[model samples]
Target: MDDSIKPNEDIGACIPRLRRYARALLGVRGEADDLVQDTLERAWRKLHLWRRDTELRPWLFSIMHNIFIDQRRRAPEETVSLDEHALEFPVAPAQERMMEMVDLESALRMLPAEQREVILLVGLEQLAYKDVAVALGIPVGTVMSRLSRGRERLRELMEGRQRVVALKVVK
Candidate 1:
């Protein structure tokens, strides 16, 4: 047994963020949970090596992040379903709002990995810029750039839909 992992210690603190980041990165709830489980298992196995002074949540997140990247490289053409329970926003009372949310999810799925990670980390997870920089092992400027580019891409997709709707309205 690894000295670093205390059997009763709660590693659960990191699970929600891990699941959220994984879902955003993989664009599928089921696969994301599987990835999170893999991360926890690996973390548990290698627990003895973990530095006591370091924060465990970020360590787990970094592990999950690397796993997501590696999986993408190994499986280039995989299509993840975004309909998982975690990714599903509440059922909106208004149908139009629900459709818009669906469109937003679709746009998120279309983003490149770098852009998606940045947006998920900074925008969704609300991590500090410094923390995200450290976790991503990238400069803070890169995070800003990816978030900007991702938001622009999302805007373009949404605007394209709006334009089509407007055209139909005029006709």
Candidate 2:
């Protein structure tokens, strides 16, 4: 067995999870793919910096997180302009499941980026609290707080109670 190739194999094993996180973060297929490609490129270039004793998955996630933050900083005003026609496609046969997914996606999009990232890392990606904190470079307390808020907001959004403004009595 070539010891030199072991790290590469380990990194390869993480690509699917990386892609999933990228897709969830970016919410667009092409953009997610681009982010993953950039992440891989960056990781390959910095492979020497990675310590053998450290876990690879969280390190890869941290790289992806930094890249994502950098990209967002570079284009703070960038928005995806979707075509209305593109969204008029037919629904899937499992309409209830599809609707639930749509609702979840909508709620996710509604979350603040920090909260969204924490929630996705903890909830969707199943990352541990400490790993999430390392990936985001935040304290564990902050992760807990953000995850709590994110879950609450998601629940509110899913339940159609996102609006918090109180109604005034009419004369």
Report the number of the highest-lDDT candidate: 2
| Candidate 1 C-alpha error for residue 82, in Å | 9.2
Instruction: Write out the backbone clash pairs for model 2.
Output: none
**Cα lDDT of model 2 by residue, 25-140, tens digit:** 77776778899999999999999988777778888988999999999899997575473123333587897887777778767878888898999999889999998998899999
Error of 1 at 161 (Å): 1.9
Candidate that scores best on TM-score:
2
Per-candidate local distance difference test: 0.78, 0.83
Q: What is candidate 1's TM-score against the reference? A: 0.82
- Scanning candidate 1 in windows of ten residues, the lowest lDDT window is 80-89
- Runs of candidate 1 with Cα error greater than 4 angstroms are 1-10, 78-89
Per-residue lDDT tens digits for candidate 1, residues 1-171, read 557665336567677778877876776767778999999998888777667676666567667777778888898886655464356545899998988987887788888878888888888888887777766778999988888999999899988888998999995
